[model samples]
Target: MAAEVKLAVRGAGKRYGEMDALKDCSLDVAPNSIVSIVGPSGCGKTTLLWSMSGLHGLTSGEVLLDGRRITGPHPDIGLVFQEANLLPWRNLMDNILFPFEVKHQKPDHGWIAHLLERVGLTGFEKNFPNELSGGMQQRASIVRALSLRPSVLLMDEPFGALDAFTREEMNQLVEEIWMETHTTIVFITHSIEEALFLSDKVVVLTPRPGRVLNTYEVPFERPRTMEIMAGKEVYDLTYRIKADIYGQSRMQARAAE
Candidate 1:
């Protein structure tokens, strides 16, 4: 374990004009643990990820990485957006090396190759984004993010666009990567099953002007699988989270009315 606290969000808030996307949200991610955020739409889950990555400025509070305040993006944090966002003109290897290029650092071919292999993109290194399947493209994108050797990985619905089978496979892939690297991960998702399957803790949020509704610790043992997910304990946790999100959505509707 790296330390007790890998990332900490304290009173974190973000606003767009009159709209408060997040408010008074606080959470601590233990080192090398997998944490997932789940909530109704417009609940600022993505904003929280952006704030943690320093991609968006915070209106108040602070995001700390390994006890240091993150005033701006740090090289040790990697983000995987919903879209693969791969450049059509670039080959897989080139795309994975893009981060080093932007930072004006020399490309680490060895690490890039290793990441490609890890993501199962070893044979497609010279292929363009258009030549790959949706799942493969996302795999490449993940490898690109990991190429920087980030200690913390921030994922915002990275598997949302894929088909159900593909999404499930990607979920397993993420778990495999986490187990292999012991990297701290904060994933945002709308799927209760996915969150329950992969997370050590699932943080539930309310609708806009989001606040932490609850945090559920997954009692299942590590190295989770589809079999574990079929267990009653896992199903119960998923049902509970689903109910929380449903209730929050209803509350938002009433408040708007």
Candidate 2:
């Protein structure tokens, strides 16, 4: 059976003064499914994500979470950005607990311990952000976002700053966590490989005034490994997505001219 839809974007449009960033884009994300949005730079990928998260309002249409329109950010959603954004002054445990601390809620020590172990940061709780590697910092940020037990997680190029190897490691860790927690996720990334590796559905968008170009359903099974990326199917899909992105850029350029 298909998964239940947990989030929906209906005929969404976004504009910044005279410039249109997104137009008539619609998508449905399933509960516990990982959906990744990818496109050429400046294609409104981030705009669409923010609109869905209710951090930015759409010019038209609506963003729905569990059938209710999202007018603003809610506690049910968690967001992670390109930068880890951990407070350098706070140690790892305190960083992960920051959200609870700010909300004045009692930290669930057991759950926090499990999260630290799940991300392989158990012993580094007292260590500062600078003491950890880039990947480690990102891990802390992710756990911190999950600290609230949000049903939906929005990640915008969270691992984009890490080296390729570190990025792959982080991807594996994310997949592992997703398998365990099954949180609905909307991830935005520029890398086709990363999108394919992490997403159940990869949504491609057109350049500025972005619209949905295509949504590819990944066929690979869960607990995926690096070897799957080298397979013929993955290679073909990667090539096709790259070609489509380039093709869209060419078409946009010609239209501008």
Candidate 3:
């Protein structure tokens, strides 16, 4: 829908021995847009995200970024997982800057400071992961992934581990980051509310051996507030998307498992 595709998944699929994880999956991501993928349990959501990262190979298709094929991990892409995965021994700032050390590259301290400020992690730089709360740790993880200023960020349920309040706060933080940086993102989540609240478009995947089912555009305007979720439109769309996911013999449960 948005002009000029930044990332494309073409007839993609992945099979492991006798188990098929994804099949004929295809989608396009326009630059700076947030696309959320949701589906039932074991629907290959993680598999698909991994394939896009080029960290895992697809059995049947390809992923292209900026018209170039992604055969392996690309520097322009970054990932954040459900857990912060921070090192216990390192201070927060060192952990955030770990990627730079791995690449033997000099980090732009200004960029680090800006990202830390954006994520509300500025003064906590000296704290270790053990000293920070879960939300703070996750924020550190986000900043770490973003330290290199990747063009596209692939997030696999990055906020799934937090409490409802903390998750909402992270969602707000994500929206702010996206607006400020205009970084393209493909987020995988099981929460339809979370997906609708944060994405420009919500992508639905079928049950196991997952494939693209449908994509719904979020008609809400930008700079959305939490109040949008309590409104009738989101309420209506939520059920509609649920019907789409449920129609396939799978229903959402809340943690939804």
> Candidate 1 — which residues are off by over 4 angstroms?
1-3, 255-257
What local distance difference test score does each model get?
Answer: 0.91, 0.92, 0.91
Ranking by TM-score: 1, 2, 3
- Candidate 1 C-alpha lDDT tens digits along 94-141: 898899989998887898787788878888988999999999999999
True-structure Cα RMSD, model 3: 3.3
* Model 1 worst lDDT window (10 residues): 219-228
Q: 2 or 3: which has the higher TM-score?
A: 2
Model 1: per-residue Cα lDDT at residue 255: 84
TM-score versus the correct structure, for each prediction: 0.96, 0.95, 0.94
Model 3 regions lying over 4 Å from their true place:
1-3, 250-257
What are the C-alpha RMSDs, in order, of all predicted structures? 1.9, 1.6, 3.3
Separate clash counts for every candidate: 0, 0, 1
All candidates in order of lDDT, best leading: 2, 3, 1
Tens-place lDDT per residue, model 2, 89-111, is 99998888888888899988898
TM-score of 1: 0.96
